[model samples]
Target: MCGKGQLVTDLESGEIACNKCGLVSSDRLQENRAEWRTFDSESNDRSRVGSPTSLAYHDMGLATVIGKANKDSSGRQLDPSMNSRIQRLRTWDFRTKAHSSTHRNLLHAFNELGRLKDKLSLSDAIMEKTAYVYRKAQEKRLVRGRSTSSILAAAIYAACREMQASRTLRDVANATNVKRKAISRSYRILVLELDIKVPLVDPMKCIAKIAN
Candidate 1:
């Protein structure tokens, strides 16, 4: 970032960026569309909007959810038959969205990535990048017979490599409960299959990380 670092939006790619530095703040930002309205009521609830969509969810937070309650949306209690029907709807809705094998694999992998992010104190950007790498790997059929956690750890390691993050393989291996060899194998698979160009690690940052 430089100068005033004014925010800019890329219309084509939908990326939020800094105009001065050309740094993308977020690539998967949620779209916000507002239809103009005149609000004059005292109890006008404008701030109670729902959560923003997220890429981290298996469904990307786009799938509809039926809340577990005996009441309807207008706060009316349902009859016994209606209650069972709503419960079945909820169960089927969840199953319909979650039944994909790739989705389940990615869901588990992302959860593993989340735990590693917490343990290693990695930023959201790094986790997002790792997720991209993992998804790319899955797309290439590189995760067919491999451990999901191992592939996710390798994805995080590859992201750190690309970003020149000072984390070591031993560090990630310890934090992710995966073996160094497994991470290496998965990393190789990612490189060979995805044709990803993982940049060299910065020696100075590595030295500083070791000294710390």
Candidate 2:
């Protein structure tokens, strides 16, 4: 090891290396900075401007919607004609976003997911996993001719199993107001089509859940 204090941090490789001996002192360092890229110092800094992209959202939280305000950039009220045109634009924007069947499906499914997340007090990780499972099932056309709520509930249960969360099918069914049998059937479909390896539930967790 080089005794020299000269260390070079490679941001791209996430490594801290000894400049003199070319030995890496650390690896897999996490970047805690804001997700903003600026090429020049003279450029305006736009760091931490928005929420991080997430799968829990139908549009992955990246799509923007026109504001309902009828005011211009300078806060001046728009003319009646202009206001009408803006309102029409807003309606079109909203419709275009969910125009496709897949988009409409996701919009509804994610809305249900949000409600269940609060009702079940599910963690972000579990919700994200649920979203991923639901997306995969949708892609495989397993959602066609099936109840969306049932498939979503099944996805939630599958996510809980994969994530080792102490949630039962009964819990999901109660939170989602879906029939347990439907959820079970949809879960089996997910396991078969997606080939997901669900982990066995811990008896201790089940006891703990019951005790609570």
For each candidate in turn, the TM-score is: 0.75, 0.78
Report every candidate's CA lDDT: 0.77, 0.86
**Candidate 2, 40: how far from true, in Å?**
9.7
Best by TM-score: 2
lDDT assessment of candidate 1 = 0.77
TM-score computed on alpha carbons, candidate 1: 0.75
Q: How does candidate 2 fare on TM-score?
A: 0.78
Q: For model 2, how does the per-residue alpha-carbon lDDT over 109-161 read when each residue is reduced to its tens digit?
A: 99999988778877676777899999999999999999999999999999889
* Ten residues in sequence with the least summed lDDT for candidate 1: 29-38
The alpha-carbon lDDT assigned to residue 146 of candidate 2 equals 99
- Model 2: CA > 4 A from native: 1-34, 37-46
**Which lDDT tens digits does candidate 1 get at residues 67-160?**
8878977999999999989899988987887698999887887777776666886765566678788888888888898888888889888888
Per-residue error (Å), model 1, residue 9: 16
